[model samples]
Target chain A: MSSIDIAYIESDANPKVKRWKRLALEPRAVKRERATLLEGLHLLSVVLEHPKAEIAALILSEEAVSEAHELVEKLAERTGARVYGLTKRLYDQISPVENGAGCMCEMAIPAAAAPEDWREADVLYLDGVQDAGNVGTLIRTAVAAGFATIAANVGTASIWSPKVLRAGMGAHLAAHFVENLSPETFREHYRGRIYAADARGGRDLFAAPDYADGPCAWVMGAEGPGVSEAAIAVCDARYYIPIESSVESLNVGAAAAVCLFDARRRRLLKHG
Target chain B: MSSIDIAYIESDANPKVKRWKRLALEPRAVKRERATLLEGLHLLSVVLEHPKAEIAALILSEEAVSEAHELVEKLAERTGARVYGLTKRLYDQISPVENGAGCMCEMAIPAAAAPEDWREADVLYLDGVQDAGNVGTLIRTAVAAGFATIAANVGTASIWSPKVLRAGMGAHLAAHFVENLSPETFREHYRGRIYAADARGGRDLFAAPDYADGPCAWVMGAEGPGVSEAAIAVCDARYYIPIESSVESLNVGAAAAVCLFDARRRRLLKHG
Candidate 1:
């Protein structure tokens, strides 16, 4: 598979192509069996930015090789991974999305280092945020805000799913993720100023306890199911992002961005 | 179709149903539809709060109807929408998402008013963003920030798509939207102000023009392909949301939320 020769695939019937395309079928496909497909130059590069990101293969359309000539070289040269060029028809079959960005990278969500680095960090624990897009966007916000790690529980979508890998737009590289979390496990490993965001919470997130209150860890629940009783129970305090009377709640991803970034503001203020 | 006698679906395989279910296939499908396919009482009720939200129809699993006897009648009476009782086979077919939440509603994205309303009002124009969920969330933010209307140009997804409808939640009731815009049309009828959000803009979105500069517009382009040349050219000013070092851009929706609400903070000062 490591041969640099372009393995052109024109038919949608290609076995690997069909399997790659099927990755888009669910937010976090339990396709635990298949190699996760990564798309777009931005995300693939993001994964490569992280040392732990594993590269199984580089699956790209032949046209992508010709068009993004420079990117193709950098990707192949850096990773030492297999580069297989498929036909456009097969690429579509391998594409998780419709706008087909012309490339896909097969990678593994390689095991993350234990929460050791996170011992002195602020974390985001996601409980069953099943939407892959939301999970991905939150990861982007988390990375941009400088969160070191994010843990997603069993019910939440895997951070490595094709859609999330795409949505994170390579933010996945900026952060580390561990999946298959249970509330107890999250509370057990994460020692920090834990705050749960709920619309009905007593305090506002903006004026939340300073990050100096300890190694802050904010837990957000899924969109509809919000933080579970387990999550709510484990939290040190509950904080809410106040909204104008115009809406009931901000979308979960948007809410997380607002809260997570606000948490970062504390560090920025103290330092700068 | 209006006969309320029996619970029925016109076909074993209907295109719209397939489309609805197709959304469940992709992680972003529901978000892309601009309509979240909400199941159960919680979200359906959350959305039903905003005025003018249309519940296209309702589907109840036969088992669910039996267990929650009052649900069917309650939903039908409250929403003036159709109710269908379905066996597991049909119910499973009708349910596009994994968390079928027992009951579901096909929420509608209300149509926008004519361009006349946007001609001289504070409008938020989406120049090129193609993400349905991003478009929807921005609309929600625009509505919250007190923008009177939203105008989405070509290259943006239809606001009425199910995903936007759901993302905007009930923002359709708060603001208005008009699709397929042209720069000439905007220049001719729009006289107040236009601010294009870009990395290299003329002004800080945090410190925008005064409220006396009422009825302005903020035009946002697709993430990668920022505001169109014509759209950017027409703007009276360009506003940048300052970011920390190492960051390239803020998610369009997040930027909109911050900027629009900052402008909205004016209403308080003006009318205070």
Candidate 2:
């Protein structure tokens, strides 16, 4: 591996080191600074594929410079991004994962304003979905099922948190996100029907009519209390996936996958 | 709350405390000792509903003794189970979660041998799914979709691990589990067709012929190195859930949910 001659930081108290640590660890800092850290080479590569991704810098552990040299060199050349190296100690402190891929990237969080035609497009609205893993998995599912826009209200887990980003598995790069959304604002702007996914006491999903025939939004909520009364009030109807009586309820992520994929399947059959 | 006479242990060095720690922290101890720990009152309540669950003991933090008095006292009375209280410090050391629901129950790990007619029944075969959360979620989904039996090959996560049990959310009590199953043994004994859930290069799941019409097994593999060659060889065909090309793959748990629920939907329609 050829030496890249990149700038290196060793001190824990360095100004840039402190800032990067904050970005990695603090959600408040991530929001206030309007930047986030993407852990590992895989997430870096995925973000690079997006044309609008504003990659600010690439940071690597000293070991990664030698181990993942080829991909690092290629990524640096393609994006002309500034590169920095840190001692393993500093890298480990900042990384959410221990002994992770040993590479990290800093980039602006993707925030696309709800489009003028957003009301006529399909959307997935997260209502107080608190778990980072569930929030991330839901975003990944929405994108794969062809929901281009995701709206998360105030009580939901922060989309760009390190844990959520790790769980998202690079789906953040492929989709547009709207955060701190309010159900009231959604009701005002979105013209299509809004459906809440209930844990129980709703129309059976398969037996329900195809609401995917037009612009629509699926409101998924937290597991225990389920969709808030306020969120449910904004919906046109509530639908539930059927399961055996013995099982209490499906995990929120699993429920979202079933609802979204079933909609996609029906839409595909209808259009074909 | 009336004072319930119960044995209290303050010392961490006690044999029961040491053993409980092993069961909570070590998979080997759980497997060898044939016992597992369930965290929280909700899980304990769910297990109590299962008629066959043998409640060996109930342990509560001093805080829970007052906070959850009625339920704890009733549980002790109902099963005539041994009840013990641990100092908060001692309880925290033995529990998997921090500031968790303070009540815990110990029970024999459910291990029902595959039935005599297992070959004629539908099953979910987990092929080397290593993530504890994924393993637990898949089991929950399997039971909800009415798949009575779950078979996991040796490489998969232990179904009774604390993480798996928490993620399974008491689904383990409702479903039968067969662990350390070999693919060769499965191939020999199970007469039903086996379909693997492939990430790519397979017939479209929606367009594929209705295999759910008969007894079958769905082999779901790990996220990266999908179904092993040995396991794939045992399958009759593979079916890929059609997804947008931009996303790499669905999380294994999500993939399993889609496949199992689709089968359930078809079967429900066929009979109805």
Candidate 3:
């Protein structure tokens, strides 16, 4: 590793500390700067490994440098990004998690792909799934299920938000994220069978004939209102998970996993 | 309906307010009191509908009473439980959610079922799935998948904690809960085949044959140190949810959903 020239900041009012705090706390600030805060060793490693990830800066608390010296050095060397050390108090203020690893970085937001970019991808479209945890879990599930791309409509939670990133558990680095698209734009540009997951009044998910003939998009709706009527109208099919009648529905994240994995199961069956 | 006798308390120091706050905020307090605080209209309604639910008190914020007068009237009449009104300040202190529905109830924690109580029930054993959200989501998913009983082994999050209840949505009312069991105790009591969900090195879940012939128990492990070795040793079979090679595994809750729902589908197919 190259000699580390780490600048130390003890004041909370430092401009760099203020910027990092804003990026962690304020979605508007993240958007304005076109950068998001990546926290902890796991997420930072993901960013480092991602071919498209652009690192702006790395910030470490005094405690973090002492605890993870080798990791900090390697990360600093790999990105050739300026490294700053914060007083523990300032680090605590900027850390999104309680007793965080005290290491964080500013990284350029992964550019959202246009509809044309996903033409050959098996896409997962999130329609207003407002819970950040659900959104992140879906991103992770989508990658595990082998979906190549993810699109989030306008009403969906910001995919780059800190809470969503934490819930996503570094899945963001592995999948293509196309954010802030309207349902209409998604309908217009995507050339694939669109399957909307419904709680009721649809063909059974398992009973539906094989869908492995081509790439498809699974449109998951929000918790309560479900897929918006406008989004539903554009779907080629509606699939219902066969849940017992006593309950209203599965949590959106759980529902997404069932659907994505089931599709994968069908694909495996067809090709094997 | 009987005349609504709603009592009002302005002071946060009031005993009733203190008790309610304790129940909402502290799991130990909830256990000692043998009750839990239920928030929002939907969960309150579930408690009201449950045949065995015993209401100790129904607390409504001024905002909630005005916004949901009909619901308040119906609940007040149905339970004959004393209704208390809190000043917005005191209400905010006790409310578990952001923008809470303003109504809550203290309902008796249903007695934990003994091993004998689960004789013919399809059981879901949560083995150290410590995240409260995951625990609650698993409970809701288990119910929707028609699992009649849930057993949380020691190290699992409390099933009736506020976060779990919120995530559960109202699954707590519909399913039987068995808490604080050892892995050996669970094995000794459950009279069915036990299946542990593993990330790898197990039979494909979809290919598992004909479990609908009898009751079965699904053991879901924690997010990190998945199904404890002790717990796995007690299982009759281990099942793996197939996923893309690049990713590690599904979230515990999502994995539980896929497993429980797949069992439900098999049951339906068998009955048909």
Q: What TM-score do all the candidates reach, one by one?
A: 0.74, 0.97, 0.95
DockQ metric, candidate 3: 0.72
- Candidates 1 and 2 compared: the better one by TM-score is 2
Best by DockQ: 2
Q: What digit string (tens of lDDT, one per residue) describes model 3 on residues A128-247?
A: 898888999999999988996999888888888887888888888888988887778888888888889998678988777786468899999999889989889889999999887667
Best by lDDT: 2
Candidate 1: RMSD to truth: 6.3
i-RMSD of model 2 (Å, 1 decimal): 0.7
Tens digit per residue, CA lDDT, model 1, B152-226: 777787666545655777665567777777766877788788888887666654444473256788888888778
lDDT of model 3 at position A183: 77
Candidate 2: CAPRI quality band: high
Where is model 3 chain B poorest over a 10-residue stretch in terms of lDDT?
B65-74
Q: What's the residue-level lDDT of B101 in candidate 1?
A: 46
Provide the lDDT at A198 for model 2. 96
The TM-score, computed over Cα atoms with residue i paired to residue i, of candidate 2 is 0.97
True contacts kept of each: 0.15, 0.70, 0.76
Can you rank all candidates by TM-score, best first?
2, 3, 1
Per-residue CA lDDT of model 2 for A1-272, tens digit only, reads: 55455778999989988999999888889888888888876787787677678888888887674545555666677778878889999988888888777888788886656656477778999999999899999999988998868888999988888878888999988877888888999899888889999976789898887778898899999989899999999999999888988789999989989999999899888885
In model 3, residue pairs whose N, Cα or C atoms come closer than 3 Å (at least 3 residues apart or on different chains), thus clashing, are: none
User: Candidate 1's residue-wise lDDT over A67-90, tens digit each?
Assistant: 344555567778777667777766
